[model samples]
Structure formats: C-alpha cells, structure tokens
Target: MSDKSIRVAVNGYGVIGKRVADAVTRQDDMQLAGIADTSVDWRLRVANQRGYRVFAATPKAHTSMSKAGIVLSGNLDDLLDEADIVVDCTPKHVATGNVALFRKRGLRFIVQGGEPHALTEHSFVAESNFDSAVGRYETRIVSCNTTSIVRTLGALKRAGLLKKARGTLLRRATDPWESHQSGIMNTLVPEQSIPSHQGPDAQSVDPDFDVVTMAVKVPETLAHLHYWNVELSRAADREEVLAAFHSSTRIAMVRLDDGLTGINSVKELMADLKRPNDNLYEVALWEDLVTIQNNELFYAYMVDNQAIVIPETIDAIRALTGLSTDSQKSIAKTNAALGIGSALY
Candidate 1:
C-alpha cells in the first residue's frame, strides 16, 4: 500500500492463511498485499469483506469463484506479482508444486510444517534461528508442537542448562471446526514410532538441540499438551529454571491455580481475554509445575496448533526480507502486534 512497507500475500485462506493475513495487516512495516485461495466458500467471502483482494489460485478456480459469487482479482500469478514475499498455507504437499512458480518471479516464499524441511533446507523458529534465515530465499516454520518444543528447550539451551530432553505430546485429533466430520471419540491413537518426526524437525531449526518426542492423537479438538522430562546440566532450584523460561517472551506461564486445568480451559481463557480468533500464540506453561531436582527438570505446557506458529512466520518474513537483522527486534515487533507476551501470567 506504500513505498515503505513490505507487501505480504497469503496463498491460502484456511486456518493459518487467514490469521497470517490479519497479522500482516497489523504490522507498521508490512502490508497485506492480498490473499489467494482455491476455495470458493464463506472463507473467501470473509476475505472479500475484510477488503483483501481475493485471487483464484487456478484457472478452474477463477471461473468457479465467479459462479459462487466470490469476486476474483485475476489469478495466483497476479497475486505473486504484487507480493514481495508469499506465505504458502495450502494443504500438505500442495505448496511444493508452487515452488517453481514462485522462483520464476524471484519471490521469497515460506511454507508451512506439513511441507518437508528439505523443501527449503532451512527450518525456522524465531528464537532459534532467525539470524540464520536472514536474507534467504525461503525457510520452513516447523509444526506447532515442534515450535513449542524449540521455544521451551531453546530457552533452557540459552540459559546454558540444557543437556537433553524427552517429550510426550497429546495432540488434538483435528481442527475444532472440522471435528464433527473427523477425529476420534472414546479412543486414543498413538504414533506407531517412538521419537516422532517432531524430534527430528526440531533438529532442523537448531541442529545442536538433543531432543526426542513421542505423540498421540487424543479425542479432543482443543490443543496439543506436552509433557517433558529434561536432564539439566546441573542441580538447580525451581526459581533458576523458571528464570530461564521467563527470558523468552513467547513462552507464557499459565497456572493450574488460575483454573487453567488443561488445554480447553486455556483456550477458554484466551476467548475470555477477547484475543482475535481466541488465539494463544505463546507456550502456556504451568509455572508452578516446573520442578528441577538433581539435574532433572520436569514440566508441561500447552501449544495452540493453529496459532503458535503465526508469530514465527511473521519473524521469518522479516528474516528473509532483511527488514530486521536482529531476532529480538523482529520478535519484539511481532509480539507487540500480536499481543504475544506475559500479561496472562
């Protein structure tokens, strides 16, 4: 919209896409160039209502969008031509096919977690590797669970207390809106393998991190809750461990004493706070539960699958664009715009 702002276009209008669109618009130095989507539904209409020009992602979608009464602004290439960078939020593996098209225009692009890390050969978590991705062609923002793991463990790693970590995750079966059509009930399903993909993915962001993860799909559609058993470098008091966690703004402490008994309650708390889309973009940990004894630390935290990566993606945008050279500066700007800090604790 102005000569000074970065033009950011979102290539999907689903859970992450729409949120990214809103976040790009809130920034003082970034502009929401437009959003491109193949869906010709209420989602597109909302983008239209919010004044984001809707571009059909395919020629077939172009005609259907008109028949569905969702006005279109040319096609995907048109949106790409106007954007300095594109965040591809299309469904899993779908973004891979678009890589050549983005390169044809020499545009910087970001792909979601469902994409493989090899797609960019660089995975990003704002706190972990923003500097490494600075002025790069692209990067992958690891999945929500991996983002939380990296944020929490990276804090400990930064404090010089981390040794290695083992984590167990209870994952939400599906997004809440689609829970009625999918997800398990009266049953729990576990990943067939130990030390799941999240463990290796965390390595993508920070190769020095020694972590292992196991996950299960639970019956609910609220959020993913993680239980961690970490070996610290030395025997430390709870205060020392908490002090390390306190250093990271993206890691928020929520207490059971505060009635946030689990993920659903945490989600309710975000809604009560009137956060946009009831988004909890931080790692909501139970400060009181964090305990360290004789070099072993145990704690648990909640991760909003749909929201945790939004800030990281924003930071990646700055990193790729060279708009902010320092991770803290870009993180601070993103946190301030998204309300991503400690007031809740």
Candidate 2:
C-alpha cells in the first residue's frame, strides 16, 4: 500500500453511491478518485457541482451525457485506472457484471449488498466481520436491514445472551428521492414469502447466527424499522441487555428526550444535527422500547437504508487495503471521520 491516501472511486451515483462518494471525500486516509453513473440526471450534476470528477458508466453514456450538457472527466476505464479501490453501488446485478473489469485491472472493489453473496469473496459488516474482510479483494457490505439485524444480534451473541432471534422488518417502499419508483404511497405490501431473504442474507455475514426475518414494504421513505424478538440462552434483565448494546460503538441509543419516536422523527433529528445528506449511520435504538421477560428480549430499532451502510463501505476500503484489522479501531475511525456518534438528546 502507498503511504498516500487510498484513491477510492464510486460507481453508480444513486442514493447509496452519492453518499459513499461524499464519505470518501471526508476520510483522512482515502480520496474520492471519481464517480461514475449511466445517466445525466440531477444526481450527476450534483456530483459535478460538488467538484467531483464525474465519469460515465460506459463509453456509450458519454455521448448522451455530453448531449445533456453534462461534462465527463473520462469513461469507466479512466476511473479504474486512477482508483486504488472501487465502491460499486450500482443497481442490483449490475456490479456483478463489472467484477471482471475490476479483476482485469487488478483492483480491489466493494459491492453493495443488493448483489448476491456469491459475487464477492465474503459479505461484510464492519462490526461483525471486519477481521474477515481484511486483505480481501472483493467485499460486499450487507444491506441496511441486514446490517441492523447483525449488529443487534452480533452484540447479543458476543455477550452470550442470544439463543434464537426472529424479526419483522418494516421496509420503506422507496428511497426518499426515488418518487418515480413503485410503492411510494398508500401501501403496506407483505413480501409474499416466509422468512424473507434478509434472514439468509444475515447468515451470509455470520453463518452461525440463527435468525428468521419477515418483511413488509410500507409507505414511508425515511427508514426501515425492525421489531426484534430475541430469545436469550440464559435469563437476562432489560438493564443487562441495554448495557450490552451500550457497549457497542455502532449502536446509537435514542432516548425519549431525543424526540425520536419514529423514523420521521429520526430524520428530523438528523436534519437538526446538520448531518451530511441527513445521513444516520448508527443503528438507532429506542431506549424506552427495550424490554425483556423471562430471557426473551423485544425491541425496535431503525436503520437508515440510504445511510447506515456508508460507514461500512469505508471500513471495507480500510480492510481491503490493509489499513486496519481491528473492527473497533476501524469503526471508531470511520465513525469519527463521518461524525457518527450518539444521537442528540
């Protein structure tokens, strides 16, 4: 590895891509090499306005982007040439197709969790699998919901408190800005399957974890809420479980005084905090809602689908680059760099 900062490129400037690019710019040990996208939409313009070198996802998109009055720094080839690592946040299945391109360049890359686990060397959640991901060329940061589930369960597992876990995920229909996509308003669609893919996805991060997850898409766009029922191996008091979560740096405890009763309130809190892109990277745990009875724990937490994984992507960059092997150290550095800490009360 070079003594200089790692050059990181972000492909696909959608919701997650744009946030990753901004995060890369904030990191002390990483640089935003450039960003690539297929369209010349407002997102591309926003990237350009932020002074990032914008590259077309492909050579063919260059002509169309130029016609749309958007200038390009170079094509995808140029981005691969300059970046030490590429964070592919392209739509599902698109990053898989680009893997061969990165491999041909001898470049390390990170993919979002929307892609299947088979596409990457291993699935990653900085807090759960940071050590496993170190020095790995291909890493997939697990989905927002998966990250939330793993973090909560991982914490319980570490404390020898978890026996079996199950949850129902209330997912947002679409990203806040993606109004044109389906399921924007007046809907509560169940995922039509028992134990949605989230359970298996979480298992990919930690195969030993036994969890069953069901999901439903709601009309809100603020975030995804998870209601978890954790059966502990031994009897545990609410205070004991709360203390375990409190010990985790990635879990941000939200007290009632924080004025965060639900996802919208959490968004408002982020806005009030002046977070970049109103990002909420930590798993927002409702302090008041945490309950336990006869070794069974129940609680509700919110995951900002568009933001929670951003820090994990940064941690993956460090892991792939041999920057850090300690999950706590990497998480601390990433969190501090991104201004991710406890929520304002």
In the range 1-345, model 2's lDDT, one tens digit per residue, is 235889999999998999999988888888899999989788888778889999998878999998997879999999889999999999988999999999998899999998999888599988788998889888998999999889899999988898899999998888877757656566689998989999999999999998999999988778899999988999888888988898777799986665667788888888988999888889999989998887789999999999999998999999999888788888888988998775444
Extract clashing residue pairs from model 2. none
Q: Which stretches of candidate 2 lie over 4 Å from their true place?
A: 1-3
Could you tell me how far off, in angstroms, the CA of residue 207 lies in candidate 2 after the best superposition?
Answer: 1.0
Highest lDDT model number: 1
Per-model TM-score versus the true fold: 0.98, 0.97
lDDT of each structure? 0.92, 0.88
> What RMSD, rounded to one decimal, does every model reach?
1.0, 1.6
